[model samples]
Target: WKQSHDKDNTNRIKNSTENTSTICVSVCVFLQTILVGDSGVGKTSLLVQFDQGKFIPGSFSATVGIGFTNKVVTLDEVKVKLQIWDTAGQERFRSVTHAYYRDAHALLLLYDITNKSSFDNIRAWLTEIHEYTQSDVVIMLLGNKADMSSERAIRREEGERLAREYSVPFMETSAMTGVNVELAFTAVARELQQRSVQQPSEPRFQIHEYIDAQKEKSSCCRVF
Candidate 1:
């Protein structure tokens, strides 16, 4: 289901923190997130909608190169400034676009619900993400254009299934109507915050090796 936007929901990402410590120091964490998908999946729209709270309608031109924006958000009471990189989705820009994935804290693999081919290409994007980004980077599968239900070619179950298979968070959003845009952004923030707590150090998260007896692939993501 498409989630309605409540501007108050932006408070999920607040800058103000409660004073508890005698030496009350402010919290500041920076999370680097990358957005990648097919050419017409509304990636730029999603970013614009979340950052400015206004939807730009009509056929917007594709992002020529990498685009950038940042917003301060609070997740789990921890303040984070999310540096969002919106990468060009065309094949011509793949060489430069995928390079920035390195050292990223989170990745948003987006697909258009109205386009089946866009959803089909998600695995390829996932492959690129695994190749370039940290193995432990928080991944979220976003099926955009939820408001375009009449034209939707991909079912919600399909999105949920893929998300479960890869153990990534999943949400559908409508950049045009501002549906679930805040929730989708904040969910990734909360995930990265929790992961940071579990992994105190930097990018390299220690993943457990699969037992020799188990013939199946590692539930944990790693190149074979």
Candidate 2:
């Protein structure tokens, strides 16, 4: 019951599921989601497909430093405005992109199933995420390019195993074919929305507070 349009942000809206729009909803949750991994892992492609409803096919280049777009989604009748950040995956851009992780509530750790190296590098990305986000941050390990079925180097079981080891959720998506694209984003939203429902009386979550709380725990555990 939700769709995305980048160039246009209409004030009025309607939906079969919620019957309300992001612009009109006085009570709505906003989550900052990021897409990160090695370059050419289809992060930008996935965002383009989900945000614009079109695929940018053929030899897509890597993102420069960072890019972002908005998508209004409905999860369990709650309206959510997802600020999805697409980060550059190269080493040089690491410094630039790492700054964006400071406030990310949900992360989309994408890897190319055809590139075993990218699959292997999820650890490095996770390390960076671990440094910036707290335990409350939602991490979803995504094996993208599922449409390249014949060229998959990383099996689904391997991805699942890696996700289990990291205690994160996993899914396979094809930005080219638009497979499971919605689920990838909405699943995270559902979790966030459920947390909000549980703590309806508390103030909206602040990014720094979440980071600081984890930092405090780590400091307390440090051996002096």
Candidate 3:
């Protein structure tokens, strides 16, 4: 009788674990992720490659204000929809870009590997992020255009050192060759998902408010 009772308890525990897993898989989460960088740093191209899986060669008429795209990523059996905004890199649009920072859950800060000035300006961008976004915002530093090895101005070690100084994750990506583009976004999404699960009661920005505000400004671009 004792052995039979033990087996019954084990079966019940297994069933309970399965039920918990099922609940976790059913969870759907939305995360507001944004990309910020200097103009000509390939921020838009990175977003395009991640969303559409293709690279647009040559120059893209720099995003004037802000444009966004949505992609669903699954992390730990949870569905996370990433609302990724591509902010204008030009100085004139800094204010416009800053306004969206408060509600962002994660940010990808990019700098051109071939441009030393762009890398140098990372401090300014980090300052703005601290000023505008919440303290817990997840940020990743990316050195883009890794494919241009011969023209590389920023060494990989330098990127790693800067990231360590700021205490943020760092990676080198090539939007032209689609290297680590997907991984970069996925890494951000995974972190966001984990944070949401851990802080279930955290106050969240209403999606409706974002939609209403976007309607007022027709400059927002939606890629799909």
The number of the candidate with the highest lDDT is 3
Assess candidate 3 and give its lDDT. Answer: 0.81
The best candidate by TM-score is 2
Candidate 3, residues 141-216, lDDT tens digits: the string is: 9999998999999999999899989988887888888877877887777666756666658665432333234335
Over 4 Å off in model 1, which ranges?
Answer: 1-27, 198-224
lDDT for each residue of candidate 1 in 23-123, tens digit (9 for 90 to 100): 13354566778889999999999999999998988757998757667777876578877778888899988876776788688888899999999999999
Task: Give residue 174's lDDT in candidate 2 (0 to 100).
Answer: 87
Candidate 2 per-residue lDDT, tens place, 1-224, comes to 12332112222112311433435465488788999999999998999888887788875787876777778887657778887888889998787667768778899999999999999999988998999887788898989999897999999999989987988877788898777677678777877876767666876644334433434554332211
lDDT of each: 0.75, 0.77, 0.81
Clashes of each: 1, 0, 0
**After aligning candidate 2 to the native by TM-score, how far in Å is the CA of 152 from where it should be?**
1.1
Residue 193 of candidate 2: its Cα lDDT? Answer: 76
TM-scores, all models, native as reference: 0.75, 0.77, 0.76
Q: For candidate 1, what's the RMSD?
A: 12.1
